[model samples]
Target: MKIQEIREIIKLVDGSSIDEFSYEYEGVKVKMKKNGLGNAQQPSQTAIQEPQFANAEEMPTTKPAKETELIKPVIEEQTADLPGADSDYHKILSPMVGTFYESPSPDEAAYVQVGTKVTADQIVSIVEAMKLFNEIEAEVDGEIAEILVKDGQLVEYGQPLFLVKAN
Candidate 1:
């Protein structure tokens, strides 16, 4: 847990023929090893005190020379906590690398959107791989949760295009 303790552990391993050693204290994991050549500088043990055994000791656990700061970042809410958690809305992902087209042409309205109900085998969108336009179909009847990709974007193999909430 502390740098000095870790150094001491390494030193103990280096001084002896112990190839490796590992143990945990109060949920903190520690491990040390000696290389194949056994060339390791062992730390001298002048005085040692186990954390559990020394409750009244006044020594600072971490080094005071190094300034430590804890930081917390703001996070935006995502739908990961929804009922499905790990599962996305039943999606119809891209089968191949291609350009994704929401509509048949530039003039036509997009096929699906958020809350749009889709039937199994419905033509949801098109992916043009190598100049050949391939129809993307929904494999399950569901409502669109989100359109993950934008129109005319280059999609890779197995890339998610739409998120579906099964009906």
Candidate 2:
């Protein structure tokens, strides 16, 4: 394209809050995203994450390529702490990739808020993706200490959905 056209495109992107724009034509795709802009300004972006789930029968339980023979002597000691000490924390991770809906919408009440009691299989929120609504349930029974997402926010896979005080 012409230099003036490219400059205009850049200007179009720079003037909007939409991060990451892509244009494709004639087998050429141009993608640009606003990076470090939020960092330079305020920190209001709410991070969203969704959980990934595969069929239990299809999941594999194996470690690949342990490239650490030099620490053979410390292997046993290292193995002792492998599980990590904070394994006790109750984490409610997202179960799907979609837009996180804290409530039905901006005018509705959130399903459950911080300090709310929840049990296993309780519907905590809904994720809207691909024109479908997936209800996210609680995997454990506990009081919610913090919710990791806001209403109408786009979420990614395997993001922290909430922090629960385990019972």
Candidate 3:
């Protein structure tokens, strides 16, 4: 019912595999739904109802006009003249929606850069979601050909972060 409680619920939903959640207490109602990856038909929505008391003696009234859509973050695709065909490269994608960091921290050097050789299990970057920093690994042994996303950029689930030319 409180703002902090609502935020906690949102954090839990964002970090988990659950696609939808709804809660109702007294006359207050809350609903949250996540859009399916690459599913253009359904857009993500989170609705919260604020109780409005018409008079001291009457119960709170809920209105549908209070519902609002949460705007998703969008990152423009960076264009680059790649050396080879698309199939010749391996894409390192973000596993969750979060802020992408090229390095562990601001003062630290990046895990990898263009032309840096990397192994399949090497941590190439970090994606911070719900205040939890997640290390993203290069799933294939390759040389970094291009860095697609910018550092500290807000990225979506399954968005490409880098293009590596497989060794």
Q: Whose TM-score is greatest here?
A: 3
Ranking by lDDT: 3, 1, 2
Q: Residue 89: error of model 3 in Å?
A: 0.5
lDDT of 2 by residue, 1-167 (tens): 22223334555666767766776554434456555544657632212111122444432242211113212333344334332225554666666656799876678788899889999888888888767888888889888777867787656556667777778
Candidate with the greatest lDDT versus the true structure: 3
TM-score of each candidate? Answer: 0.49, 0.48, 0.56
Count clashing pairs, candidate 1: 2
Candidate 1: tens digits of C-alpha lDDT, residues 56-165: 35334543221111101101122223334345567567897668999999999999888889998899999986568999998888888878778987665566677788
List lDDT for all candidates, in order.
0.63, 0.60, 0.72
Runs in model 1 deviating more than 4 A are 1-85
- Superposed Cα RMSD, model 2: 18.9
For model 3, how many clashes? Answer: 0
Which of 2 and 3 is ahead in TM-score? 3
Model 2 lDDT, residue 33, Cα: 56
Candidate 1: worst 10 consecutive residues by lDDT? 66-75
